[model samples]
Structures are given as C-alpha cells and as structure tokens.
Target: MQTLLKPSFTRETAFLKVKAAEDAWNRRSAILNQTLNTKMVRV
Candidate 1:
C-alpha cells in the first residue's frame, strides 16, 4: 500500500507525492476520454 504523506514529510518527499498524484489523475482522465470517444463513435 502507498504510504500516506504526512505533515512531517520532507520537501522532496512532498514534491514526489504531488507529482505521483498528478500522474495518476492524468492517467485516469485519458482512460475516461478514450472510453467516451469509443461510445460516441458507436452512437
């Protein structure tokens, strides 16, 4: 399981955590867009 970033985290750790979250969000968005496009094309 991913460790939760707490207030005691170092600056570098905090930055890495933020970057990871952004990457995850982008990935999910891409998947959602692809699914929507495919459904739209079929309609």
Candidate 2:
C-alpha cells in the first residue's frame, strides 16, 4: 500500500517492521493452533 507508493521508503526499518509483523503473526497462529490441538486432545 503505502510502501508501494513510497518505493524508496522501505529500506532497513520498514523491512524490519514487516518481518517482525510476519513473524509475530506466524507465532500467534502457531500458538492458537497448539491451543486448539490441546483442547481437542483433552476432549
């Protein structure tokens, strides 16, 4: 979005932000999946 418009804007910090966001999302999804699996096993 904004990054596409501002091609020169995404260098180091922007890259780090995007990477951190992606990693956080993946971790969150993995945690949720694990919780669901644990609940299923308990049942």
Pick by TM-score: which candidate is best?
1
Q: What are the lDDT scores of the predictions, listed in order?
A: 0.86, 0.78
User: Residue 20 of model 1: what lDDT?
Assistant: 100
Angstrom error of the Cα, residue 24, model 2: value is 0.5
- Candidate 2 shows a clash count of 0
For candidate 2, write residues 1-40 as lDDT tens digits.
3544556555898899899999999999987777533755
Alpha-carbon runs more than 4 Å astray in model 2: 1-10, 36-43
What is the C-alpha lDDT profile of model 1 across 1-43, one tens digit per residue? Answer: 9987768888999999999999999999988778533755454
**CA lDDT of 24 in candidate 2?**
99
Q: Where is model 1 poorest over a 10-residue stretch in terms of lDDT?
A: 34-43
Q: Report RMSD for candidate 1.
A: 9.1
